[model samples]
Target: MRPPKPTVAIISPALRKANNGNWQTAHRWSRFLRAGYDVTLASEWAGPTAGDLAPACLIALHARRSADAVARFADACPKRPLIVVLTGTDLYRDIRSDPAAQRSLELATYLVVLQDEGPFELSTAHRGKCRVIYQSAIACHSHAVDSEYFDVVLVGHMRPEKDPLTAMRSLALLPDDSRIRMTHVGGALDDEYLRAVQALQAQTWPLGERYSWLANLPHAETRRRIAGAKALVISSVMEGGANVIVEAITSGVPVLASRIPGNIGMLGRDYEGYFPPGDAAQLAELLQRASQDIGFLTRLRQQCAQRAPLFAPARERAEVIKLVADALRPT
Candidate 1:
């Protein structure tokens, strides 16, 4: 028999139950790495115990949330590779203020950002080790859209970072006769959001008739919804790179995204589908334009189609596997 495969440990702060981007990335990466390495997935990393072999490398998601594990691993295995994956909060917020997040960046043998714009946030010292690994989704057949309504799907939890309220508010700004419908798929994280969505849903005509909140569907179901919609709206104020964007593109659906660095990175700067973050009126204008102008909507779809190949699973899988293989190779 050949030698046993080397072990790899993946530390993800959010797991399957969270059903969020970090979890999706971790779960997908685990499946990709399993063919070459023995993989263990968990929220935290405890050092090896009696007779337990240490992982050849540790890949941790979210520099801030996984800082403790990264620190422990660094102290225990100073010579081994430790990879830290930065999330939106880590890159746009915590790395600038949080000591733990900063320390994780310094201790990491390699740093990964999910989009091209991520490295610009790093300091000169940290930038040298940073790399971009665009996330991917398998292509799903596009379902025929209902001409009665121009359905726009938004997938993200109810949180300040996601800025989901912006999308909801935009629905009210649409024209009285606008056929644009907002279908939101995410659970409210707090009572404030719960109340906000409930209030919107309870309203008459424009808001209530046009808005539908599914509140956290399964991943497959969410993808199906995205594939069936006329377009997807991503209203996040911060994102390391959204998996939903990839899902939307791969499903042959266009995206109306916020003008944020992470989003600009995934969808090129020239792409015709951006609205200012938190600007309800602007988002409303884009949504209304998309609904009424077939040529404009088709333009957005064409632009998204151009970028879809970059998020293909084959390309992502190769890049991810190469990152690991290179890290484990003897220097």
Candidate 2:
């Protein structure tokens, strides 16, 4: 009889209902690992049951959010590998200050950061064990775009970290004749943000209804909207890496990203489609240019095209499988 495949457990703080980047990542990684191992996806892990063997490895999605699971796994299976994947908040906000997050980092056998610049945020000791694994998305056929409007999409929850208000605020700076229209695809997590979005949606801009808030569409529908848009905008103050950027690139859509380390790591430092984070005037100028300047828009598209190969599903799958295999190998 053939030997059974080892079990791997992936712990994500966000699950399917959350419909956020962490859930998407955990779901995708589970799919990838299934080819070589038995994978279980969960929001938390307290250790294996009384009669069951512990998982061969534990992959925890957020350092701070999944700290308890990581701690439990480490204490229960000291010889086994523990991989902690750092999210935006973990890298940018928590690991530096939060004790639980720092402890998770210390306990992990290997650490993963989604973008290249992630290692820079870590100390020298932790940096040695970290790897950069860029997230991937399968390519999709572009939707039939509306030529009447230069559509732009922002796909993330209405959270403070995402800095979505900058995208909304940019509309007031656009010229009266600008044809750019913004479509937001996310649920507002806070009452203040919900009210803000509602208020923005109610206003009529010179461009004739510039903003539309489609609260939390299904992933397929969101991708369809992204594929049809002229460009994608990510105005995050911090990001480990964004899945939406990968989706946009794979769907042949360009991106206008905030000038942040995580974004620069994904899009490259030379990419021209960057504006300073939370700067409405700069974002508005870029949006106006994207709508009116065909040359500039084309340049952005070409630049995004150059980066698309980095996010190929095949490449990511191979890298992910290798990481698991290495982790499972006897020390």
The TM-score obtained by model 2 is 0.98
| Model 1 TM-score relative to the real fold | 0.99
**TM-scores of all candidate predictions against the true structure:** 0.99, 0.98
Give the clashing pairs for model 1.
none
Q: Which structure among the candidates has the greatest TM-score?
A: 1
Q: For candidate 1, what's the RMSD?
A: 0.8
Note the Cα lDDT for every prediction shown. Answer: 0.94, 0.93
Kindly report which residue stretches of model 2 are placed more than 4 angstroms away from their true locations once superposed. Answer: 205-208
Please give, for residues 1-331, the per-residue lDDT of candidate 1 as tens digits: 9999999999999999999999999999999999999999999998878999789999999999999999999998998999999978899999999999999999998999999989999999899999899999999978955688899899999999999889999999998899988889999998988998999999999779989999999999999999999999999999999999999999999999999999999999899999999999999999999999999999999999999988999998999899999899999
Poorest 10 consecutive residues by lDDT, candidate 1 = 141-150
